[model samples]
Each structure stands twice: as C-alpha cells, then as structure tokens.
Target chain A: HNGSVFHPGTIVFPAALATAQAIGASGRDLLVAAVAGYEVGIRVGEFLGRSHYKIFHTTGTAGTLAAAAAVGHLLKLNPSQMLHAFGSAGTQSAGLWEFLRDAADSKQLHTAHAASTGLMSAYLAKSGFTGAEHILEGKQGLAAGMSSDSDPSKLIDRLGTRWTIAETSFKYHASCRHTHPAADALLQVMLKQDLKPSDIAKVETLVHQGAIDVLGPVTDPTTVHQSKFSMGTVLAIVAHYQFAGLQEFDQHFHDQDICSFRDRVTMVLDPEVDSAYPQSWIGKVKVYLNNGEVLEGRVDEPKGDPGNTLSRTEITDKAMRLAAFSGGASPSEMSAAIER
Target chain B: HNGSVFHPGTIVFPAALATAQAIGASGRDLLVAAVAGYEVGIRVGEFLGRSHYKIFHTTGTAGTLAAAAAVGHLLKLNPSQMLHAFGSAGTQSAGLWEFLRDAADSKQLHTAHAASTGLMSAYLAKSGFTGAEHILEGKQGLAAGMSSDSDPSKLIDRLGTRWTIAETSFKYHASCRHTHPAADALLQVMLKQDLKPSDIAKVETLVHQGAIDVLGPVTDPTTVHQSKFSMGTVLAIVAHYQFAGLQEFDQHFHDQDICSFRDRVTMVLDPEVDSAYPQSWIGKVKVYLNNGEVLEGRVDEPKGDPGNTLSRTEITDKAMRLAAFSGGASPSEMSAAIER
Candidate 1:
C-alpha cells in the first residue's frame, strides 16, 4: 500500500486520451490500456524501494515506463518490440526531486511528459524500429544506470497477481505529499479543540527530517507554488478555515491574518519520525492556545495512507471535484466510465 | 563557446511559434522574442560549465529557463513574476545522463519539453498566477539542488553583454554529440585514401572518455535508438556511405556491409584524447588496410565546432539537404525566414 494522492480514474483518463489519439485506437481500447497502465505504474512505484527518492521520482519516471508498457500491450506489439518500447521508455525516463525546491510546475508537467512520451515511444516502436533486448538488465541498463541498486526481478515479479493502482492514495488537498500528515494532524487538533486563529499563541509541529527538508520555514511565500509546499501556510489555512483543499491554492490564498498566524507555527525536526517515514507517514502537532490550553495530536498513519484506505465512493468524489476544476467532466460520468 | 549542436532556425522557429500563440503576441514581437530566447538559452548552457558525458544535459534544463525569461521579457512580466516563471521552470526542470544510455527518443523529446514547458510557464504567469520567486537562489534552489553545484549568478551574470547562440554548434551528423568528432575523423580518412569498405581490414578509433562512455563497443544494438548511440554503428555508417545524417535515421537506413564492417572496428578509450574534449573536440582514427597498409586521420575539431563554424550559406546547405530527405520546406525558405 502506498500513500500517493492519485486516483485510478484521474491517472488513467489523461493517459487513455493521449494513447488513443496517438495510435488511432478506439475509446474502449484506450480505457483498457489505461487501466492496465495504471496497474503497472503503481506496481513499479511500489516495487522501487521505499527510499528510492534519492535517485528518481517514482511517479513520473517509473510511471512513464509502465504507461508505455501498457500502450505497447494494447497495440499488440510482439514481445521483442514490447521490450524495445520499454527500452525507449527507459531512455525517455525523467523527473527530478528538485521540483520540491519551490513546488515547481515540474510536479504537474512530469505527469504530462510521462503520459505524452510513453504514448509517443509506443507509437515509434510500432513503426517497426527495434530497441535493446536487455534494456532493464544490461551492464549500463536502466536499473544499473539510474538506480544505485535495484532488483531486476521486481519488474515481472508477480505482475498480474498484484495490482498497484489499488494501493494508491487519493489526495483531498493539493499540497506536497510530505505535508499531508502534518496537515491532517493539525486539522484534527484544531477541530477537536475548536481553536480559533486569534486564540492560538503558537503551534509547534514535530515532523520527520524529510518533511522539514521539503516543506519547512514558510517565510513569505509570494506564490501559489511556494504556499502549497509550506507547512506554515497549510497550518495557517487549516487553523483559519478548518480544512485544506484546492481553494487554498488560489492567488489570494494567503491573507494577513493567515500570514500572522503562520508566523506563530514553528516546525521542529524529530529524528525518530525521520527514520519511520515512507513506511509510516507519521506526524505530531502541539498547539498552544492563548487561554493557557495546550492540545496535541499525533498521527501514526494519515488517512490517505494505505493503512487507512479511501472507499471507491470517496475516490470518485475527489476525482469529480478535480475534474470539475479541470473542466469538461463530471464525477458521476467519470465514475461510471471507470467502473466499466 | 558552447559545444552543443543546435540549429538557430530550428530552435527559434518552434520557440517563437509557441510563445506567440500562447501570449497572443505578434510578428515583430515574436521575432524579438525568439532572438532573445535564443540568446538566453545559449548563454545559460555555456555558463553551466562544459558539456560532458556525465554532466546533466544542459540544453534542456537551462534552455527551458532561458526560454521562459525570453517569453517573460517579451510579454513584459514584472521582475517578480518573471522570477517566478523561472522558478516554475526550474522546479519542472528535467533531463538525465541516462538518455545517453542508448540514445533513446527521449533525447529529442527533452528539447520539445523545454520549449513547451517554458512557454507553458510564461503563459501561466501571463494569466496572473504566481510561482516561486527564489527558485534559483533560495535555500533549496535549482542550482544547489539539481547539479553538484550551480552558479545562480551565471543566469544574470552577463544578461546582455554576452551572446550564447552565436557560439552553438550546428550538427553535421544525426548521431549522438560525442560520436561526431570520431565520425568526422573516419570520413576524413576514407575520403583521403579513397578506399572502399572491402579494402579495409580493421578500423581502430581513439577517442575521449565521453565518447567511449556514450558509443563504445561494436556489440550488437538491436534498435535504431541503441545504434545511434553506438560508436561501432556510427563508424560503420560513416565508413560505408562516407556520411551520416537525418536520412540515415529512417527505417531503411541500415546495410549488411556496414553492419559487418562495424563489427570489425574496435574502439579504445584514450585518456589523452578524453582530456582534450570540450576545449578541443578532437579524434584520431587508424585504419588497417587489407593490403598490409595503414591509413590514419586525426580531426582536431569537427566542422560544426565554434572555431570552424559553418557559414550562413553552409547552414542553409545543410538544412536544404535534410529538407530534401523529409520532403519538407526547402533550405532557402528556412534560410530566408531565419535571416529575417
């Protein structure tokens, strides 16, 4: 089970549209290809060791290859050509961790590139060109070159039996993944204590090293991208609104009161939490109220983590919500199509 | 001076088209924007140190930022907004050493991504959305995060006094950049001796570390992508046809004799030659003839290197030659537009 904030439909739909159009494939074929792609993409992401973050972005880079494999399968490419397609996909693989630097657009574009390039690689392979046979295991192969260490057998290691798409997390907010646990914990504490922004003297967050490395010290983030990655901003928004979602990404997402409240929130890095991350996306939130009240909440596992899975209905609701913002699709329509 | 291969017209044309369409910018505005983008992209690549087999592909990552800056300048985005656009581009920045793993399609796609993403960031900023401001200089900036080290000052170091496009290398062959020097040397030797492929017993190539890392070993390459990155295949194509270009990348480009001869050629890594690269893109070739004779040729600098630059007429000639193969616009038309 993984804590990725992507729903099956959202991941599969965009990929299906691009794959179908590129190959002149039918809509039904496209849907089947997308479901297959989502399954492989999630599995590859999971098989990659949990600490693989130091090497590559599992979603965009590995996801692209999985998507390519699905397109290859749908196009009915022979085994040899399918391997070539995977090789081509491997060569095209890209998505750097630097995106977390400022909540850059690369985060979104990584998906766009993976979807488009995976489709393109499949089409190119279908045009009768060959690729490497041992792309994944060669001396200078994908795993050898990109990953410091990887198990080649993990690729086909129980592929059809276990599906990765079933294990992914569906995001309820559009913030950095690392910030979700803290945001979830902070929201719970505020809700339980009925805390008001003015009544809070200080809010202290004890989080993993990775969290602070990713979303720490929000000193005047002037842009939506920066605010989205800021713990201070997320906590402030939560304290003020009692929730965090896409609305928090608006241009005027931050107000003076929110900014003032954000200044009072300090994040302390805890090594114990740092060691447990990816395996346990835990967080601890301590709130100091102005009325001399102290409330604390510790989340060993966030709601979206595989440990606490969202129902299909809940996933459909979030997808529809996002689709409404993305335009031209409704939740029920998407759910029906996905169900098929 | 940069050693990267880029056609000014090719780079400028696509960049101009996307930026103009996205911002509703027009004629003269588009032209100025293209020129500005070319200048910035080239300069940024140059400032990132020199291109090598191991370093990140500078063109795509730095080029995206430069293109964004150019678009921002044309659209007249304020300093803060322009910086955010740069930050947005940086976060989205990607391109890896693994692309050279087998000269995959992702190689070309990198350029397309840079062009498209740069335009996308500028368009987003134009529509009044905000992005990170200190994407380059923040505690976790692009330079500090992506590469071993980056000089943010290089971005604005020589804002206007320097011109980068003026120094770019226009490729003479369709293969990987590292293989160019050796291919140039092989062609020189073949042309001088006027020897047929059958007359050659064995071909020995001495090249730099970068070349070896990219295209060493005559071992089999099952696909076109792999062959393009193979020194053996490149030398085979060059020895057989006395040239390698875009036409040779087509489906019917391979010949049995070339493939056979490619197997006969042995490539060795020369530390002496490797040390001279970037500063001097030189390669040495020694051919053992069938009749107990040895023929040798050394190319200190390829034709497209900045020192031995291709003139406007030469560039046009090259474009026209490529256009003929693709049934696209004539070189004259491309040259005319570029001159304008």
Candidate 2:
C-alpha cells in the first residue's frame, strides 16, 4: 500500500456517505465506494506528500482526487469522463495549514468541501463537461504549483493492484494520530512498572525529527490543539491521568499537576527514529523514578496499525459507547438492531 | 480598476442572478453586489495572474473570489463572514486551461462552478462554520500554491473606492476580445475604401507583442477558436463580411473565399504597442489593394473599452437585437417591458 501523511478515513467517509445517499446505494455499495475513495485518495496524498504538506492539507487537496475517483467509479464513468473528473477536481483542490494556526474548525470544513467538490466534478464530467486532460503531470498543473518536489508516477504506478485502504491504520486514541505512538509507549512503561505520577522524576520521549517538528514545545498546553499536538502535554496527560481520554483536552485540566509535570518532559530527536518516519511512526520513552529506578518502553508500530488491529469485540464496544454518548438508544438494543 | 485576465461578468452575473432571485433582490441590489464581486475578483485575479493562468482558467480560479464577494454582499455578510467566504472559496477554486486546447464547453462550466461555489461559501460562512482567516495572504495559501509570482496586498488595497466594474469593457465583437482591435481596424479600412474583397492585394496587422502571443499564426482557422485567436482569419472575416458577427464563426464559413484570402494577411509585433498593452489594445492595419492603392487604418482602443464606452442607445439597441434573436418578441414591446 502507498503511504500517505493524512488519514484517508476522514476523507473517504464524507465522500462515500454523501455519494451513497445521493445514488440511493446500499451499505455494501457504500463500503465498496469507500474502498475506491480510500485507494485513490491515499495514492494521490502519497504522491503529493512532503512539499504539499508544508503548505496545504492533504485531506483537502488530495482528498478531492479520492472523492472524484470513488464517486466516478460508482457512476460507472467512462475513462474520458474519469479524466475530466480528475481535471476539474485537480483545479479545484485547495486546503491550507493556516487554519491550524487559529485552531479553527476549518479542518472539518476542508473534508466536507472536498466531498462536495468531488461530487460536482463527477457530475459535470458525466454531463460531458471537459476538464484538463493532464491535470496532474501537465507542465502547468497541480503538482507543479503545489509541490516543490513531486513524483507523479506515484499516482499511477501499481494503482489498481495496490489497495491502500486495506493497509490504513485505525485509531483508538482521542488525540491526533501523531501523538498515539508516544502515548502508547508511555502508557506501557507506567503500566509495567506499577508506578504512579509521584514515582516519576522526569519523563523523556524520543522520536523522529519530523515528529518533533509536528508535535513540539514539550510544554504545557493552553488549548485543545496545543494538548493534541504538543508531545509534552500529550505525554503528561497519559502518564499523570493514567489514560488519554477525550476529556483530557478540556481546559479544566489546565491547573492539574500533569500540566506542571509536562514542563519536566523533554522531546528528543533520534536519527534512527527520524529515518523511519512518514513510513513508520515509531516512538521510545524513558522514565526516571524518585526511587532511583528507571523504566523504558519502545513501540515500532502503535496499536491499531493494520498489523495490530483492534479486536472485533473492542471495536463493537467502542461503537456502542460512542452511540450511547451521542444520544442513541441503549447499547444492547442498538447492537440487536444492527445485528438484525 | 484592477485587471483580470478572465471576464468578471461571467462570474458576477451567475452568482448575482441566482442569489438575487432567491433573496428577491431588485436590479439595483444585483448591480451593487456585482460591483463588489467584480472588484474583489479582479484584485485576486491580478495577483495570481501569470503563473496561475499557465495552468488554471482565470474564470474558475479568480471567478470564485468575484462570486463570493458579490453574493456575500447581497447576503449582508460582515467582514469575518466575508473572510470565511474567501477562505472556503479559495480552497475550492479550480479550473484548468486544458479546456482551451479542446475548445470544450468547460470554459462556460468554470464560470458556473465559480457561481455555485461562491454561493456555497457565503452560505457556509453565514452558518458559523469557521475557515482559514488568512486564506489568500497566508504563508501556506492559495497565492503561494497557485502562483509563482503573487502579491496579495492587491486583494485589499483600494477595495471599495476603486470600482473594477466601472472600468470593465463590454465586448461588441463576436470573437475573443484580443481580436477586437484588429477587427475594428480592418472594418474601418474596408468602410473607408468601399472596397470589395477582390480589391485587396495583401494585408498586414501590427499589434502589441502581448496580443500577438495570445492571438497567433496569421493563417486560416478550421475551428471557431482558431478564427477567434488568429489575426489573419479575424481580419479576413471583418474586411470581407464588413462585420465580426457571431454567425461568422460557424463552420459553413470555413470554405468561404475569405478563408483562402486569409493567407494574404501577416501580423507584426510593435514594441511601442507591446509596452502599452493590457492597458491599451491598439492595432494598425495596412492593406495593399490590387487597384494600386494602399489604405492604412488604426484603432487606439477597441469599441467596448471604458475610455470609449458604448452609448446607452447603442447598448440598448444591441440588447434588443440579442433578445429578439434569442426568441424574444418585437424589440419595441420587449424594450418597453425591460425599461419598466
């Protein structure tokens, strides 16, 4: 499977669900459409990675490709029509990292925008509206404008044979996926040693230089975004709270002991780990205890990776809990209906 | 007024008409909205002009800016809402120049896409969905990714007082605006001489280098686009037919005597004219007649330029002709109703 920096699910679900509803498709059809959506999106994202990520959101920029491919497939578009879809979708592609500066909900908006634009592109192409034939590799095109260094072969090489969705990672953590490895590593050390927050002298998390650039400042987080991105705050929350729950991002946790202990945490750049990233998001953590004892944990790949997927029971339980929290019926009744 | 490579009317009219119809706005409201739309769109287009034009159609790229501004004005959007409208619209901006190669209907499609996207942006912003605050001028933004040479200060400078629509040109010729000056010069020469096509020996058109670059190859055109962009074909049609009407672009005229005579025409580059262009679309035509007479004609500005605005009677008469040609009733009755 091709590697992408952004989660394909955030892009695929919005497009698939919207298209499914529009076409009166079944759940199975939605799944198949989602698969195509994920594959196309992931490949385009992987192709436009690095330089594109420096300025734009992979979810919005490359996600349009996924959406168009998936919806176009569902509509049984001819190759010419498909090309037009890509043309229109490529021209429309846009999303920016600037939103992250304001912690704006524009992140969600980006996904929605991609979904709708993809739908529009497909519909127009189907109606015989022409788009650029060489939107990706053309001299003056998306990659040329959006990427400083780009390899378009990544977009088509082994396209049909390689199924990116099958290799996608699932997430159990509430914070950003980037923080999951460190959180997993830290939790394991504390769990194995049976040590409380008071037993720790200081905590250090080591990962790739790329990770440090993304998750930085190893300091207290004043906002939810800061908590999600800052390794120090994420690690502090995991170690001190003994769990990395959604509530950990709340502002009420600001005055907690974890926020102060977050200052003691340091993030280091390990070249070994640095060489592994964007392909492998690995993390290693070391803890010094007040009792003059040390514990260490390392994770090459965090839980929920394709190699270490969550069990069916765990997934069902998580689903039920989420449904109940979102004002659904009792978990047992909901499960029964779903099963039926 | 800021200059835009794409006609702002295509973008402005679609968004304004749709939004006005929905909101029950009067003609005055639509006009005001259109003015705002034209100004904002023109500024953004000028900023992203060269590099963006290489790949993207200016209509689809900058048209969104115009649509959003115009519709957002009619919707009474505040500054922050307007910002979000721009944010979402810019990300959704896309249209490729590849359509030009095919002479496809996608050129018109780009305008429609901008109209809908602009409306959607305004609607989403009004609903409190957040978008990037500095979408245009941000470090990682539309200008950065879309243009190799971009200056975003133009987006806000003299935004209100400098009216782009006021300076807008209203094209009367059937062909592309680039061909207008040459057509005007040719028609003037023909009218002065009262000459038949057989009377002409050879023809030479001297225009700015910029115009030559856009309208190339002094040769016969097989397609309407070629006729529109070719200096020779346009000159032949204007001189022989004595009019550059819409019907002259039809394929029936491809085998006409003018097509063969088009070979007698040549285009020249004038450095003085080149330096004056985009601001001035001037062309000089010199014709050598078989009757041993050389007639010279020049036009400093085409018929539709703001400096040589068409009179109200001329505008109304042209509108009535178009309306009647498109299945409207008698001009007198239609004009009376329109005036009311």
Query: What would the per-residue lDDT of candidate 1 be over residues A179-228, giving only the tens digit for each residue?
Result: 77777788888777776678889888888765665565446676777787
- Model 2: TM-score for chain B: 0.87
Clashing pairs in 1: A106-B92, A130-B223
Candidate 2 lDDT tens digits, A68-162: 88888778789999988887787677677666555556677778778878878888889887676777766556776677767778788787887
- Candidate maximizing lDDT: 2
Which DockQ-derived CAPRI band holds candidate 2? acceptable
Off by over 4 Å in 2: A21-29, A188-233, A241-247, A250-276, A284-298, A328-330, A337-340, B181-236, B239-242, B250-277, B280-300, B324-334
- TM-score per model (chain B): 0.82, 0.87
Find the candidate with the highest TM-score and give its number: 2
Candidate 2 accuracy as TM-score = 0.83
Candidate 2: how many backbone clashes? 2
DockQ of 2: 0.44
